[model samples]
Target: MINNRYDFIMLFDVENGNPNGDPDAGNTPRIDAESGYGYITDVCLKRKIRNYVELVKEGEKGYRILIKADRALNSKFDEAYEAENLKKGQKGKNTDDVNKAREYMCKNYFDVRAFGAVMSTGDNPCGIVRGPVQINFSRSISPINIQDVTITRQARTTGDRMETGSTEMGKKSIIPYALYRAEGYVSAALANKVTDLSEGDLELLWTAIINMFEEDHSAARGKMCMRKLIVFKHDNVLGNCPSHILFDKIKVKEVSAPPRCFSDYSITIDADLPSGVELIEKI
Candidate 1:
């Protein structure tokens, strides 16, 4: 099991793609309107991570995903309670059953233990868990230009195109180029609370992050790739320094104007010995 605190910075780039779309805005790429900088929600990134993990550990034990697309939540909670010869608790002090169900979920599901979940939903309250690992929303270092293009399909659903003599028209969005950065933290003490968070799991996480976009292909997302991943590990179970101070050391310097690729930016790390801390680069 992991015994130290960890923090990391991930840099990824997208070319001619919509990394994340805002449903509220007609499925356009999400952006910081004032700054014109694009951003991807943590939920969107986590979904990709979950997909990668599922692909890698499909038949492995303790790898079932709790928040799968087709699974029912309440049913899973009920099943967990039944496994421990228990029932649902009514969201008060008497939450032994909820704890039992949460334990079962954390023990069986990788995402539940890695990213946590709000199991206290619907009628089967399994309580809530604060997983040791947490990731922030990734944001572009430079402003991005979103381009909307009209698309046409050759055929129609209800009527034949021969009669109408017209193709189905729709819209799609894309980003010319954007480099995004995301930060994450892991607490060893928090992992001790409910999960083992073994070194194998840690390795799998790094693998998933590196290969997340390889299998997720679509017309809307084109030429997506991870550029770099830097991890700062602390020797203590708590931590060596504040996260903000550590993050300040990793700098992204703007080198070229109207940047179209990852080469236009330079990533630098300050060399200062924060005692009991180690730096590891996964990419």
Candidate 2:
């Protein structure tokens, strides 16, 4: 079950596909062996979405999902900034004194190296670990249509050739897959105080809301990843209801692929064990 406050998460395990491909080369979400899957990130985000809508049964009526895509950092900062200032000099008070400031002088918070991340592409694109946006009841008070959001992480540019030199080496911005951990919290209004919506009610409410977008099995699987979910809650929060947010960091304890194997404990004593059995346990 989820609460009043929630955070929506989205990750793109892009192996080798670009929904927005380069126009020069071609205009399409390019698909290649390198293209990664969106399952992990999508599922992590959907979990929280499911929780939030479910927790707020009535709130679901006005529920709407909005995605504020990544905003770019301005580039023209290398130039100088000029400002008028009156200075007391040996000659006299001079108002014509204009001082030149470095382009970045105005803003210390701007990440000077961030723009470079946006430029790298190809097999390795910019990795977006951007913080999730928080939405509360008051902000989502108005009734709106519920829309499923599929954030397609695409490469904006091909990475520099290996010969670009060490200085040109940029971190791969495009990640085929990223490790994500899902966590969440609920508000006090729904937790401490009594509300018409119960945990069961919230779950039921979300079941319908989520199903609207999860119609196709393949789609749901593809979008929701492995169909795993994790949840949490917070108390005395600004909002009165429980909030939900999806987590992407779920990890399998162990993973094995390929050829199957049979244990030595086969039905017949002489029956041979299958190949590839690292070790076998017996009851």
Best by TM-score: 1
Q: Would you estimate the TM-scores of all the predictions?
A: 0.94, 0.24
- Residue 154 of model 2 has an lDDT of 39
Superpose all Cα atoms of candidate 1 onto the true structure and report the RMSD in Å to 1 decimal. Answer: 1.8
- Residue-level lDDT tens digits of model 2 in 1-283: 2343432221112222221232443332222323321112233344444444434433343232222123422222111121222232212222122112211221221111111112111221122212222222111111111113345433334356434433332221222222222233333243323222335444443343334224333322223221222232223234422232112222222122210111111121212222221111111
Residue range with the least summed lDDT across 10 consecutive positions in model 1 = 86-95
RMSD of each candidate relative to the true structure: 1.8, 20.6
Q: Please count the clashing residue pairs in each candidate, in the order shown.
A: 0, 37
- Residue by residue across 181-266, what tens digits does model 1's lDDT show? 99999888888766666777888888989999998988789889989988999998899998888899999977998889989999
Cα lDDT listed for each candidate:
0.86, 0.26
